[model samples]
Target: MLFGKKKEKVHFNPGNRDDGVDENFVEETVNKIDEDDVEVVLKNEENIDKKFSGNNSLSKYMELGRIMVSMLKDVKNGRYKNIPWFTIATVVMALLYVLNPMDIVPDFIPGVGYIDDVAVLTMGVGWIESDLHRYLDWRLENDLGI
Candidate 1:
């Protein structure tokens, strides 16, 4: 029987993927955030801009989530180019990781569990920080009507 060539597997390892995010950094950052106390980070960039400040880590966390959304949106709108595949994968994976009920640490665990989600978000943001900054600058310029 003839058949097409078998496709290579594409694995996305959130803990140690490319785009420069290492496990060490993610673990360290995750340990610092009080996941149990995390609240709504932000509703919009303007809110982040106005409300993000020193000692406001929750807001920054939300900002990272929003940045992921914005990046995905920009990709859909054809505003981004040459985006690294790992970056895209990281964002989608992180988003999914956050919502997945069955993870290394389940979300229903209450206090300590959300830390995993936060860790995913934090590391995902770290991997795509430059891309996020570029998108953020573009967004700010366009939003300002400049």
Candidate 2:
């Protein structure tokens, strides 16, 4: 009977399904998308670097709390004055991480982790290394060992 066939229960299990459908398809698709996305992002970032790496502002204190703390300590101790743009970038990224509605690793997944936050933070730090010395030196001279 049509209704009887519809009512019959059919169970599909990834490990035990008798049909030739490969259960790993879903996992493979997700992995491929992740890889492709990463490559595209890297290319885009490289292009952006060539255009606007200069004249960027430092991140706000709230965004770069640790860096801010360090800089602030230096300021109080008379060691530094202005925070660097890279430092600001790190903070801005942090702010995005904390406040952004979208997560690098979507929150829905149970086991996998997030890496976008780390990537941005790393880029920011690397960008700031060269200017760090100059900023620190200026702070030291103006703040008298802060």
Candidate 3:
């Protein structure tokens, strides 16, 4: 019973929860994203930056967001075709998830609202981390300045 209590506590912790955003939901949303969605993210770049720059757990992933945005822009302009469609979609999904206020955890909640966002962003970054590094290298080689 003591061990069960410990397990329950850990399960409830946002940082350790396994019931975060669903992969199917992410895939469905990502599939629907188009040029307009990309435009929305680009237009709200400053807002996104502000969200990530805030003093929270999500702040650490700010660089990841920046890399994703840069990759999205390049892909949009056809300057980066080396990335797979799934990677592009995953990045878009993550960015859009941040922009959405009514996600798995509503952003209005104090102290814990961004937990799910961070989880989603983390998952997306994990899925595309290698591609992101490759993109950065490409940028450097081409003088694109990552």
Candidate 4:
């Protein structure tokens, strides 16, 4: 404790009642975003690698990113058709949010920039946990890497 202020632990509130996430807005944002955009993002894992490099402090969001990567890969290859459009939209929206540096908090803050991103992601993935876990397990079972 010699040189700087202790960073406040940014708590993520995933809501108690209905998780407090505005699903409609998330869906609309996803719907408005071009599928090409999502594809572009999904296609460029280097971009994802770069984005993840900038903020390693938030693993939860990164985990979400991994989930999205799996989903995106499946969708791109025509191997999985069971993903609902809403889920796809939400995952794409989270990826877009992470790539944006000037979100609810600017990424230049050094210590607090990615808090909102983490919160957004934690909430975004709340409803999709089962699907993600299933996909993750399937990947494990099938020895898929991406």
Candidate 5:
């Protein structure tokens, strides 16, 4: 302490609510998703789009979900293979989370219900942004429009 400044305690605050959808939860859920789950998400694409259509901000995240679905489909069909498995799983998890009505904040709730869904999608995008960009680049190179 003689030549250095006094140490100050630092408190960490995540600023997150009590919603059960944290990083660890997302990771666990992502790990559990398989090809079948991705298919389920694909089948329910209409519902997912409808659910997020009314709001502009939510619509953006919805589009991200759609892009993820396309990437997943391409990967499954062997059309695209540049993405990592973790990225694929994260996308599936985000889509599944949006499709579920009984998530941390039930979709049926008014106003703030989709907040957690958006958060999950945002987190997923953050985790796989580079991979996503590479996929997009591949799509452009192949003339497969997004």
Candidate 6:
């Protein structure tokens, strides 16, 4: 008789979509990033190559960093949250590239390996640009600028 007990029903309801934080919104924003923007960001080697300013450009970088944290938090809180697949893909690919014995351009060639890391990360970060903008606005409103 104990084994025959009925299982409870599971219900699912998608959360509100108005907030810019929605995964669909983030995904759409990332998908819209074009080659020109990539080129612009990449061409400025100073921006890409230099170590992230301790505080300068801090807001933009923090915006991205926050989204990553927030996504994890939301998921932990039982919300129907989803991280954009592309972000995961980029990170995984980068890690795989590192683990593989062979590389497109060996790390032995100074600067090239770091450049590849920057490029992949830049693309992943750029995907969440819209969320970053929202995060920046929040930082600005709260006077949190670096």
Whole-model lDDT per candidate? 0.54, 0.38, 0.73, 0.64, 0.74, 0.39
Taking the tens digit of each residue's C-alpha lDDT, what string does model 2 give over 9-41? 222233433544443542343223322232333
* Candidate 1: segments with Cα more than 4 A from true spot: 1-57, 144-146
Candidate 4: where are CA atoms >4 Å away?
Answer: 1-17, 54-56
Candidate 3, residues 52-111: lDDT per residue as tens digits?
A: 787755667787788888887887677887876667667777888898999999988989
Put down candidate 1 lDDT per residue, 13-91, tens digits, no spaces: 4545565655565444433333121222212334433322323555666666666756655654556553554555556
lDDT of 5 by residue, 1-146 (tens): 20122222222222444444455655566556666787888798888788789898687877887788888778877788666556767777788888888999998889999998888888668777888999999999999998
- Those runs of model 2 whose alpha carbons end farther than 4 Å from true positions after fitting are 1-65, 72-79, 84-90, 98-101, 107-111, 132-146
TM per model? 0.56, 0.33, 0.76, 0.74, 0.79, 0.33
Number of clashes recorded per candidate: 0, 9, 0, 0, 0, 0
Positional deviation of residue 117's Cα in model 1 after best superposition, in angstroms: 0.6
Candidate 6: pairs in clash: none
Tell me each candidate's RMSD, in Å, in order.
11.0, 22.5, 12.4, 12.5, 12.4, 14.2
Clashing pairs in 4: none
Q: What would you estimate as the lDDT of candidate 1?
A: 0.54
Q: Score candidate 5 by TM-score against the native.
A: 0.79
**Could you tell which candidate, 4 or 6, scores higher by lDDT?**
4
Rank by lDDT, highest first. 5, 3, 4, 1, 6, 2
Best by lDDT: 5
